[model samples]
Target: MRVPLALLMIATPLAAAKRPTVAQLQIQVKKLTEERDSLKQRLAATDSLQQDLVAAQQARDQAKADADAARKEVEQLKANLKANASGGDTLLKDLEAARKEAEASREELAKVKAENAELRQQVAAAPREGDLVMLTRDVQPARPLNLNRATPHIKASGFFASRPTGVVVVNVLVSEKGEVLDARLLQGLPGDSPDAKAANEACVQSAKNLVFDPATSKDGNTRFKVWQGVGFYLD
Candidate 1:
């Protein structure tokens, strides 16, 4: 059928407008592909980030465990050091106490030695007399009549000058070193004489050489500490 020319021309322009060009279609396909690929890449990157986060968390846990172990070790070391320090302090205190005790013992020993030395000197410095006899000790205790005839004469000089006139009493204690330690007047004679003191001194001097009989316990034995009183007068 024959178409009108004006209608054909308008229909031809409409068809041309509806159809797309090759270059424009290609551009649109490229843009759509790029957008799909970009979305896939973004999902992959998100997964990688999740894995990194998990690894970091694990590392943090391990670090915490290591720190705890280190802390425990330090605490144990501190405890050990404290114990050692306390033990050392006790040992040092014991050593000091021992040293002080040793010093005190040394001082006591020195004091004992000094006392022994003094006793020795006293014994060595005592007077010596061989000619003088121990008349009172040697005389027979039962019968003693002659006063002037005694070997060691008891002279009535000094405080008892009235010879053979009155009686005098004296107290005496002898030491271990054969020396007169104490002498005192128990009673004085009535006469004004220095003889009593002289007689006492003579007795004391003669008593120094008095030999003692061996002593024993409760058994019947000769005793050493012997005491006697004597009186001398002119006939």
Candidate 2:
């Protein structure tokens, strides 16, 4: 009986060790549930972090695109400015050329006016047909008269003396006796002003007083008409 009792005691202890208590089983189940919840929260945090990374990458790309656009715009503006500068320079050169052309035209106009005046003078001095003879120092006359002797007869008014040097052309008719038949003013100063009229009358009167040799034609006719120029000089 004692031996069976000892064996029974050993068997009882072994059974208690093999089977778990109710309270210890509940603690293990609670621990396993808490571990599962912690793992779920970590997965959620990883997903949110991935989404944030994607958003950051998109923003960076957008900023890069905007910067590139700005740089391109700046380059375009620079090109436009350079083109405008070149155009401005060309316009300035064209203006300078135009000014030079205008100056040359003015000079040419002045030259033409001078040439026209000289031509007028030459036309006035030219000889016409039907003249008896051209009176020169070389031609000997029947009775020579000094033209300088008539200088005292020339009358100068205050108005005529105030003007610049001028000229008067006269036509003179002489008789066979070397007497002046008529004297007329061919051309005088340009205007018909009082000064011009006085100058013309005074020159005509002086020319009428002038004594000259009888000018003859080739046939020795003792009548002639002569055109002469007289200059009025200011002292």
Candidate 3:
């Protein structure tokens, strides 16, 4: 009932080959899993770097404010020293301490500046670094949208400058300080001409750099997620 020797020899190699395929497939699966884990780690690292960069910017700003305050204190101390000329020794000691405080603050400010520059470079060098801007439509400000204080420099080049009766609508996230955090092109021109595209880009830029009154409420608890339309009309 068994196979002959010649047939058995031939079938043996086929079975061996089949066995190796499963092992090879297992190896491939393991390799793929490792790659996936590596990618996940990289993505997590990128997010961490982005957060650090934001924190560094905030620290740098605070350092600058501290330096300014220290300078003002030194100036006031000097004035007090002059006014209290009779108590010269006491005022001189106070002035000296104020100068030292100012110097320390300046040094701290310089250190923060260098750290911020380094962090910025790191963030820029990241291959998969993404924008921190988040555009959301679920925003209701306490006050109504006021374009009276919103003045966008909507000067389009190439097509829009010479053309007339065209409008570009942009959705923007405005901060409590009246700064445009980010913008997206909600509506562009009808056609896809080079000029049209350029105009649309211009509209986005203007929206990003737009100057407007703070859309925040009296308690400053408002988000200015609003649509802004820039238009060109014939004279």
Candidate 4:
């Protein structure tokens, strides 16, 4: 018997198949759908992880840069501290040296002051040594009594009726050539009274009028600066 072509085609698929269970087909379809969803989730998770790693690396790089800047600043501070310490030491040494110099100057000034005081004392103690030496050389020898010198300046008026009236003392400095340089009354009656003034004047005149033999030194040379004191006594 000859079969139709359409029926042959349909019958051919049926002849090759073992009969399929409906439960097995359903299980296979479920397994394939789960595998596709699992693949999509894994891809999304990988992308998120890559993004987090990049942010962490950027933070680490910034921290490293900040650490380098801090280290440089610390080094600079250390250098500045060392420089200041050295300068302070130098200043201390200079101060000590200046102190010593000032002390020495003060000591020297004290020594100078002491020397000046001693010099002033010496000057005050012996004021007239030079004057005395000159006077000694000028004293004339008035001894050996030349009493017969007929005096024109002295006259006896039959001796005074009353006790002689006036007495005076005068000091005179004779110049180098034996001329009276100065005459002054040292002690006498005090007054503007004519009698007292006359007496004083007379004494001064007498001193000036008197002449001495030229004074001589031990070597017989004429001396300078003779001084004399003349006293007028009433008896």
* Every candidate's lDDT: 0.38, 0.47, 0.51, 0.43
Ranking by lDDT: 3, 2, 4, 1
Alpha carbon deviation, residue 200, candidate 3 (Å) = 47
Model 2: residues with Cα > 4 Å off, grouped in runs: 1-144, 152-161, 218-235
Which of the two candidates, 2 or 3, achieves a greater lDDT against the reference?
3
Lowest lDDT 10-residue stretch of candidate 1: 1-10
How would you encode candidate 4's per-residue C-alpha lDDT over 142-215 as one tens digit per residue? 21121123111322333442222333555556554555667676545466555455555655665566554434
Per-model C-alpha RMSD = 68.7, 66.7, 23.0, 72.8
On lDDT, the leading prediction is 3
Candidate with the greatest TM-score versus the true structure: 3
Q: Model 3 Cα displacement at 192 (Å)?
A: 50
How far residue 126's Cα lies from its native spot in candidate 3, in Å, is 7.1
**Better model by lDDT: candidate 1 vs candidate 4:** 4
- Write one digit per residue (lDDT tens) for candidate 1, span 4-75: 111000112222566874334434434443344335434543565456555545555554555455455545
Please give the lDDT score at residue 227 for candidate 1: 25
lDDT of 3 by residue, 23-131 (tens): 3443444445334433543464468777877787787787778778877877887787788788878877877787787787778778878987887786565222122
**Residue 17 lDDT (model 4):** 52
Candidates sorted by TM-score, descending order?
Answer: 3, 4, 2, 1
lDDT, model 3, position 73 = 79
Of the pair 1 and 3, which is ahead by lDDT? 3
